[model samples]
Target: MKKFLVLGILFALPITAYLFFASGKNNFARLPVLTEKVKDIDQFKTNTDSVISFRDKISVVAFFGSELDDIKGNTFNLDQKILEKYYDFNDFQFVLVLPEEAETRTQQFVTEFNKISESSKWKIAYASPQKVQEVFDSFQSPHKLDENSFTPYVFIIDKDLQLRGRDDDEDDGKLYGYDSSNVAELSNKMNDDVKVILAEYRLALKRNNREK
Candidate 1:
């Protein structure tokens, strides 16, 4: 019975991980490629050329569905420790896309974030339902949703702009299907991605610094 229990635990772990990350393995996805003409959180109108294109840099593009309650005190699921140490030191960034209802509220959140951290390390952007549709349409999903994206969902993009891993959200980007089941496990994986991104950035920057 002990041996059986141990084997079961091992098997369960891999299955869960596979369910979470396997979707991003496919190169051709329904999501839209990053584009210009998007507005940053500062209400600045800039093209994609002005921002850090993740072509060679590690990037994270998470489409939040706009939960007003999360903003009581600057709510964000990604750990700040991981963000400050790894993301800030490394060349990491995030795109906090806006939902339909939270346009104004999202802007306020951006302001609050800047008030908290004045550094220009990370960035936030807003995308209308139409723009978001450009992404979801390719996947044959409904691009015209009046509501926001469901909770507990995140998308992980790599340097090559390939969707390498995802926590939840179906093939159609409907919602998250948990691999870890527990909140702590999910949170840890999110942190792991940030740490790896920082490590990658350090190597690149170091190489550049040595060249100089």
Candidate 2:
């Protein structure tokens, strides 16, 4: 009876440990996709006449509108909190969508920001006001753009062009965007969420390679 009990304990211990670790990995939560198939930004043109699209990149997108002076501080806050941190990630980018009229202002802003940090991965796309509204509307989020077509909030867009955010967020039930002026929200919530999404993709890539 004693020998049978010992054997049962030894067998169950390893199985229990395996189950515990495997469950941790399998249950790792991904940042939820709040909206699906967001409209791509291919219709816009960059300063270099290059095309920018959301097809295969994890993008942090913002709208600066034509009044670039108003959001200068907001842009800096985002640069320090988010862009400076994840700009080096292979498929990660910070894309600013501005009205075509803001081209000169955008250039000066970019040059000013570059003096502080590398801005190569910071892309600027210019489109008409109507077209900018068209793209923003496609997000299907509850947030709204101001009369100037500017929002102090920035959004996270995944490789599939889907909006990624918390559905049961503590502050807002559904958090569609992060307020650029709020440092705490960016440092804590946005920082952690970005890490989660990046890790999610890395794991997926590893799985694909293994299958191949």
lDDT of each: 0.46, 0.86
Model 2, span 1-212: residue lDDT tens: 99999999999999999997755331369998999998888878897768898889999999878898788789888999888988789889889988888887777777877888776568888888888888898898887887778988889999999999888887798989999999999988888788888999999999999999
Candidate 1 ranges with C-alpha deviation above 4 Å: 1-52, 70-74, 79-81, 114-121, 136-146, 166-183, 200-212
TM-score of each: 0.50, 0.86
Candidate 2: global Cα-lDDT? 0.86
Q: Pairs clashing in candidate 1?
A: 32-135, 169-175, 169-176
Off by over 4 Å in 2: 1-27
Output the worst ten-in-a-row residue range by lDDT, candidate 2: 19-28
